[model samples]
Target: MTAIDILGIDIAKNVFQLHGADRRGRPVFKRRVMRDQLLGVLSGIEPCTIAIEACTGAFCWARKFEELGHRVKIVSPQYVKPFVRGQKNDGNDAEAICTAVRQPHIPLVPKRTKEQQDIQALHRARQRLVNHRTATICQIRGLLLDRGIAFGKSITKARRMVPDILSDMNNELSEMARDAIAELWDLFCNLDRRIISFDKKIEAVFRASPTCQRIAKIKGVGPKTATAIVAAIGDGREFRDGRHLAAWLGLVPRQHSSGDKRVMLSISKRGSQHLRTLLVHGARAVVRTAPNKDDQMNVWVNDLRERRGFNRATVAVANKNARIIRAVLRTGEPYRAAI
Candidate 1:
């Protein structure tokens, strides 16, 4: 009997599809197992490489398989998609994973530690609350507009004007309408409090982690950005270099070049959208203040802004910052300010 060189498991909520392949990539066994039997089946097989697609529970399964004395590779679903043959059933999906894992050049998602997951969860929860707050603000503004009471788009303006408008019984708002708007206002305030609470939690995490504090030393990177980067990439050892880290964050330009001609577009916008947003927002803040200072970094920022315009300059700063952050994490050295 040939040894199973690689086993790909297409995991779902209940059922799981397993595709085992030999050294030559020939299918040795194709089986389906329930959630209860998954570990039992894998435990019986001789230790080999297990390939799984990156998803909600992929990391947990990877850790389990690693404990079972088998190597695990979490391939991105996009990489597995192109390898699927014929129909798109569970067996085929599992086979596609096996095929995708065979290619050594394909980039693999790093297995995140439990601590990293916890930090990521905090960021996610905070972002969700922020989104809810924004929606609440918009609703409050829109309701006021319907009653012929309008204010500036700024959130501060909405917060102040809403209460004033609610108190003044001189406008078009009826009793029922006023009560409804008042409830939304309460919700807005509640969301604000929740978001603030999350902010403090993240700040605590940042303060406690020496690595996060070190990353925060980069001019544009604040406590939030530092924490987010650390949560997403841990110590950054998996990345080859700064450029590799930047590319992974989708800061690198998209290419459409063929043959001798070269065509470059905007940033690829891959990977974690939240991380990319934080980096870009921080860079934008830096770019906005660059004109006021004469520091070495600001000088370059000003020159770039003059040459490429404001938006491009902001992205360039973000890309540069991402690379710098990767170096800081990888080297474990303190970030030095440009004199």
Candidate 2:
């Protein structure tokens, strides 16, 4: 029997397909194993380099594989897709992963630690609650508009007006309509409470982590962005430099160039949308307040905004912030504000 030098696994909920190759890249075995038999089969094989596409549950499997004495590489699905032969299926994907792993200089995803996962989960839960709150507010506004009781777009304004609108006998609101509005108001209040609870939890996480605290010192990074950056990228050693970090976050412009001709488009927007949105929002806040401040960053932002317009300048600031964040994470240094 040939000794396997590399193994690729296409993981699914119930079934897993594997393709193993020898030192000379010759196929040693190709088979599908039930989820229950996965570890048992792998335990029988000698330690080898295992490659798997980074997806849902990929990190968990990576940790498990490492524990079994095999070095695991988590390749992004995009890189593996190029190596796929004909039609796509579990067998072809497993083969493509095997081929992609052997390619030189292909970047692999770092396995996230349990703590990082926990922090990210918290952020995701909070984001979901925020989305729900927005939907609830919109629903309330729509319902009020139907009855000709319009309130300002602001949620605070709506909250204040809701009680008066519900209780006032002057309005033509039906008893059933008033009751419905009251129930919706109660839901709105409940969502606000839940969101605040999540915010407190995130704040606690930021306070407890020294790295997050340091990150929060940067101009455009608040507790949420600070904790998010720390949770998303650990030490920031995975990338080549700060620019690479910005590019990874999709802050940099997309390129379409061939030969000497060059064309640049909007941002690639390839990575985490949540992180990019946070950074952009923070940058917009900085840009809005830049005119009143005399700091070096503010001056630069103001000049950029004047020359490139507000939207471009905001993105430029976000890109710069992303790079600064990378540098701070990489060097373990505190951010110094310029006078």
Candidate 3:
């Protein structure tokens, strides 16, 4: 009870490990409590800074702790790993969290509000469905290929060709094989429908959010990218600047350097891959169409594409767009493209 300044909780499904430290980082107490008893235990202690690893239930717990007037710092698991002493147990993990939270330089994970989490959940669900749909398409193609039938890779082509192939008796497809492909085709259609439904929901979310609309004004950013960036980092305040946001999105290049030699590799690819992908895909579209536009952004994109090639140009546009997004969010101003 030596005026605990920071408390770390290694959270799990059932048991919870707690480590309390004073302002000077000295351990005050260590204990283990059940899930149901967690609140009761914390309610007795004076409100202090609580540290937890960013994992499955960390955000929910952070919200709960904040309600109890305790400041919560959620550090990424990788950042906390270096601070762990001895073997990796619940107690040691808790101590590691406590130590990591005390470090002023370590970047903390942004605390997401309930609405942001819901948006992310929607994105995750849609991504999964998309993956399933892709798999189904590939499966359909592979099945047909085995029977010496070949068609274009386009999803539309596959949908039109498959039924014709199944109906024709001149092909090598057996009845059982046709039945299996039919089942998979049905599954693909179902998944496609589900994905469309999710798309509508995302559209609704984008239409409702003014922040999403403002950022979407950027040439490369669509409603999807705008919603995703907002969902990931509310007003972009957590990041120091737009490059910080780009780096968080893994748009920044990785570096390996010593002495006077500096070697930069591909993008670090950190943070959310989903958001990064959306940004890059949107940027690619913009880059592709840059040749037709006379805006400042398009001119830069066209010149970069000619010099660095298409892929590099696309990534460069993504980085630039991320910075623009951060500025828009920070200043509450609309993005204006230069003529």
Clash count for each candidate, listed in order shown? 0, 0, 0
lDDT values of the candidates?
A: 0.93, 0.90, 0.92
Compute the lDDT for candidate 3: 0.92
Instruction: Assess candidate 2 and give its TM-score to the true structure.
Output: 0.95
- lDDT per residue for candidate 2 within 115-234, as digits (tens), equals 999989999999998898888888878988998878899888987888888889889788888888788888888988998998999999999999998888878899999988888889
Candidate 1 lDDT by residue in tens digits, 297-337:
99999999999999999999999999999889988999998
Clashing pairs in 2: none
For candidate 1, list the clashing residue pairs, or say none.
Answer: none
Off by over 4 Å in 3: none
Compose the digit string of candidate 3's lDDT tens values, residues 291-324: 9988787888999999999999999999999999
Say which prediction, candidate 2 or candidate 3, comes out ahead on TM-score.
3
Look at candidate 1 and tell me the lDDT of residue 59: 88
TM-score of each: 0.97, 0.95, 0.98
Please state every model's RMSD to the true fold in angstroms. Answer: 1.2, 1.6, 1.1
Lowest lDDT 10-mer window, candidate 2? 103-112
Off by over 4 Å in 1: none
